[model samples]
Target: MAELQDELTATAEMGELAELSSPTEEPPAPPAPPAGDALTRARALLTTHPVADGYCGLPATLRTLPWYDLELGDSSVDTDIPRLRDGGVSALLWTLRLLPGTAHAENPVTAVLEQLDLAKHVVAEYPEGLRLARSASEACDARAYGRIAVLMGPAPAAAIGDSLATLRALHTLGLRVLTLSGASWATEAGLTRFGEEVVREMNRLGVLADLTGASARTARRVLAVTKAPVILTHSGAHALNSHPDNVPDDLLVDLAAAGGVCLVPCSAERTGSALGDVADHLDHVRRVAGPESVGLCGAYDTGAVHPDGLADVSRYPYLIAELVERGWPESDLAQLTWGNVQRVLRETEFAARAAALRRPPSTARIERLDT
Candidate 1:
């Protein structure tokens, strides 16, 4: 991997970009469009910006769960945001959860820290991403509404010396969320006293401890030691799917009690098949953790051939509509769509962590708030 400076050292050409579009930045009005035809209006100007002007083509400029498949390059630096913004994804979380034994062309920590420039750029170029980044809003903005973030990893903390520094660096980048353990088990937090120091540091830094692919013991010990809210970011229900990767109901409840959530998805790790059976795990977490702390996220575009009814990112509105058809309250559906994540991102206390690092923030605060 190449050494990347913290600053978003863009070539001079990129420096001339205009401020992001705002309500005041709209084109002069013409005739009004119909209710469902709003997307047509949005699609008309999807390519307004040069970088985004001719990007991903779809029926309309739309948002989805931002995808995370970055290769180390100049394009990698800023490629995701424009597509994510154009895709209608309000919040973008890069799924750079490194697989085990995948050699890095560069240092992994550098990869994450380099993103700070990216975060700044996203905010600058797409203020909507900044609002989505800051407020974690669910309400759609005409241009954009999503925070651009990176998944902390499938990496174990032991992989990086002074892993606390990585957590601190990520938090500084406004990376408020991270997974507990990833698929490959190289140097994960799981190895270090069940990641006690890592979890403690993550909690202190206001980072989330995701328990997506962890063992029961790893999950429990992490829950026990971590002061930050822990989450099962995405998984199947062990109660139903019974896959090792699926989280057991008991742990699910513990995560909920800790003020965290369980993200159920249609991925094979959770659902065994690519059925995109979001509801199976959603309902499962609902039973285990209750309605408030349960939610959904699909690891789509893996070419993993989705089961019928759930093929692409565009299918999300259908998922929400499904939740509604099941007699679920709109409030709960909102939580599933965006509220729970919003709570996690906004309510998390990174300022204290940063403050503590400057001097010392109370670790006890993490315990108090986490429980």
Candidate 2:
């Protein structure tokens, strides 16, 4: 008891002596950099890497006259394209402007053609800053030339209908990617005979298939049939939050095994309106299916609320920097940024050529589910 009391008294006396001498101590270390600033060096590293946005939405007025004429510095515009380039984004999958529904259009094929025309018009208008990339190598060329490579695509396989000829035509029209389900739809065990044929054609035509808004079952079936690596361009880990939009861990594992990448969606509705939530989704996918299996798809200009720290495309540097601060090595960050998806894109091109030579157009008829 005496020893304990003496020890306490000695600690108290020492504390008091230290406090008295504290005036001579150096000023407390300057406050640490703001969260974003801490990642400054990491952001700089992005310049040397080819950063790609797996999915990016566009305004409803995409086809309106002179929409592409908006100046780069125009903050009034929903997406600051110049800002995206400054942040080191070299390639992006820009969605095609389609009519309301697949079946409601007067001439669906013409609608598709019009969307392609808009894409070409933008590239022509901004020749120095943008170009349409039809292959992975073209994207790399755009990066070397300091231009943003725009890869035009559409959502939902339904838009192409059951026409293999349309799939081939779209590929020739500069359509390089197709989001599996354009919007929310019913879930099924797997692809219908018609859907399976669609995958076969996509694999043959060199169009990258994205299961962004697809149901879990449909994703599995597509994964099973797609000969090339697939992508879930903008999805979250369901195990973390169980949001309908989030992909479950089992599917993630399957996706990785099938050589596909799951690009973490930056939607506030799924990851919350905080940068930390975005990091959480990234970390969870990394933990569940390795960092190589994960990538990013910032759905900018989609009208979805964004995290304060990531309000626009210019803020990508902060996100990359945050991951670095959390001890993510540069190599892993490369895969998350562009390496993995680049490889997938390149391989899809090769697979397409092979399929065109040896694989015949699927003779399978459309198998109706509603029937």
Candidate 3:
């Protein structure tokens, strides 16, 4: 019995020794941090499809502060180079408008020319950060080069006076958009004969007609007359908000059917001052107009209040993050951020080519046509 017990103890000791002699196994690696957070995902999506903000009143803001440099971030304004870059903004259609009560409102054409010059000067001044894009393709190229494309235009056809030659000249000066306000015509009756001719001429010039402030009748008339797809640069869904700047459901339908884009703005006046409110406007537009017909505009630097989460250009990702939390598919968000506007620009260019082939520049003057 004593010998058997000794042999058993020896065997147990041998097993323990063998176990200790074996190589130690590595501890399992710590689990990686979660990458599915809404903000993180939103940032990832933006890296591929950066925001192509349809309307930014930065030019007007810059016009006021001639000595201000955009590179040095300004606390007074919502847009700056740093903020725009942080927001993943790839392109901006900088609106050039001489407000009715402003200093140079009398000679709108010259004032508009000065505004255009300022826009060009800024683009040239910040060659490393901004590139003046005359077309959609140039905007894309600017993105590839890691620069923001600056597209400039003056609002209201009145800025060009009553001459089609001025309109053509503006296009040559890199005016990619021209807003057709109801005030441009001599009368309030929808669009006069001259207005229709202006629309056609704009179609030929490849300038996007913006109907943001146009009356419903005028918007519809422009829609019917324009050969190219128009854009409401900084508008919202009127069904959601009762603001005059918002587009009605019927107009939304017509705009979408015409292959135009309605860029939902993040202004408190047009959309409620909350991230969710802006998202709601986006959802409403997408629901009513289809995803392909919807886009985004910060409407920054316009002296209007902004939503809580979208207070400035840098807040775009947060709004995108909110949409992400709401189960918005990345594909749809891509369209909202960039694809829709790019498509509209491409289609507008195509229409312009077709229009040029169909007819030469109209010699119709407002005097003769309206009489």
Candidate 3: regions farther than 4 A off: 1-36, 184-188
| Top TM-score model | 3
* Candidate 1 structure quality by residue, lDDT tens digits, 153-208: 32333333344555665566566556555423313344344246556666566666
Q: Which stretches of candidate 2 lie over 4 Å from their true place?
A: 1-37, 59-61, 64-71, 97-110, 182-187, 363-371
Q: What residue pairs are clashing in model 2?
A: 156-182
Q: Give the TM-score of each candidate.
A: 0.61, 0.83, 0.89
Q: lDDT of candidate 2 vs native?
A: 0.76
Compared with the true structure, model 3 gives a TM-score of: 0.89
Q: Select the stronger candidate by TM-score from 2 and 3.
A: 3
Q: Is candidate 1 or candidate 2 better by TM-score?
A: 2
Q: How many pairs collide in each candidate, listed in order? A: 21, 1, 0
Q: What does candidate 3's lDDT look like per residue over 156-232, in tens digits?
A: 67777888888888888889888888454623468888888888998988999898888888888888888889899
lDDT against the true structure, per candidate, is 0.50, 0.76, 0.87
Residue 329 error for model 2, in Å? 0.3
